[model samples]
Target: MEKTTRAAFAFLLAACAPGVFAASSADLSVTGSITPSSCIPTLSNDGVIDHGKLTAKDLGRVTPTLLDLAEIQLEVICEGATVFTLTTFDNRAGTSAINPAHHGLGMINDDQKLGSVAFTLFEPVADAVPVKTIVSRSGGARWAENAYLGHEALTSFAAADGPNTPIAIEVLNARLRAFTIIVPARDLTVLDEVPIDGQATLQLKYW
Candidate 1:
């Protein structure tokens, strides 16, 4: 499988200050790194991963116990006003063309759902736009996890069966720019490394 590249960059924006420094705009910005590749490292379905019990031998396999895995961590900052829609795809299903809640629109896990893969957006500040939609593979409302207006510095959700999952994020306002990290593996316990080709699109809606 082909390896994905991980990278990071810092962006700065100038904005007017509201206080004593009103004469000039302040340099507003967010700093972070894009670790595209890291071990997703999954634990046993019923046990903790840290114990290191999930291995080929445990599953009656004769191969070595070392599992190949990796993960992608993307850090982004919205300097000012903006909105975004983030979605993912499980290769077992279709492409990003399908909505996030197609299979279900509630919690991450649902029996009707076929393959599993989920995406969560994290915002440090309370002013971030709530997740408007979490489309699924079946093209219907499957889950409806409520929004945490406050008291949550960051929000996140996990996905199972993500080997061929497609991750995507779309911003409502052109003011926001996005970054990505793509890992070469999923579910560390399985030890199966899959290759993924990442793509993006900025669709403008006019009505």
Candidate 2:
């Protein structure tokens, strides 16, 4: 009887060993590196472009109304000569009356889109040398000169005589022109004071 009991206990232990020692968890790791170089970007006028007050009568009744053109100076200073690009983010995303490429001016009545703003970069100078503006729609895989800086595109500067490739620069200065358009008045509710709220952020990306 003692031997039989001992054998039964050993069988029970073996049967439960796998259930007690089985792996029921896993580990995940996240990692990234911080570059020693950094860049800072600034815009003129504290990055504010006020369209001023406009009455409902000033808006277009059937067609989209074109607002005045605004220009701001963009400057980028790097810790050292670095290859980088500029990308834009629309704070008022998905509200553009036109398309995703354009930045949005807030909506009206909670659902009706108000308008959009388009940006273009021109007259870029790098390290005191005149450079051409280049844009990459494929996340820096390929580049083209004098293209519109859409929301999905990256903007960089290249030497005037060089091919359409981004270059390293310590300082960069360029002109950003903003073209704004309001949706047709018929599509919006202008009963109250509707503000034109358009905001965007320009980001510097290492190439």
Top lDDT model: 2
**After superposition, candidate 2 runs with Cα above 4 Å error:** 1-34
lDDT of 2 by residue, 1-207 (tens): 999999999889978897675566788999876767899999999998888998888988999999899998989999999999888889999999987889999988999999999999888999999999998888889998964766789988899999999999999888889999999889987788898999998888888
Q: What is the Cα-based lDDT of residue 138 in candidate 1? A: 31
In the predicted model 2, the residue pairs found to clash are: none
Model 1: lowest-lDDT 10 consecutive positions? 149-158
In candidate 1, clashing pairs total 24
Query: What tens digits encode model 1's per-residue C-alpha lDDT throughout 1-207?
Result: 122222211111223334534364679899876433221211122211122223323332322222223223333333332232233333334322123322111211222221212233232222233223222333222323322111111222212223222223222211121222211222123335222222222121110
Every model's TM-score: 0.22, 0.83
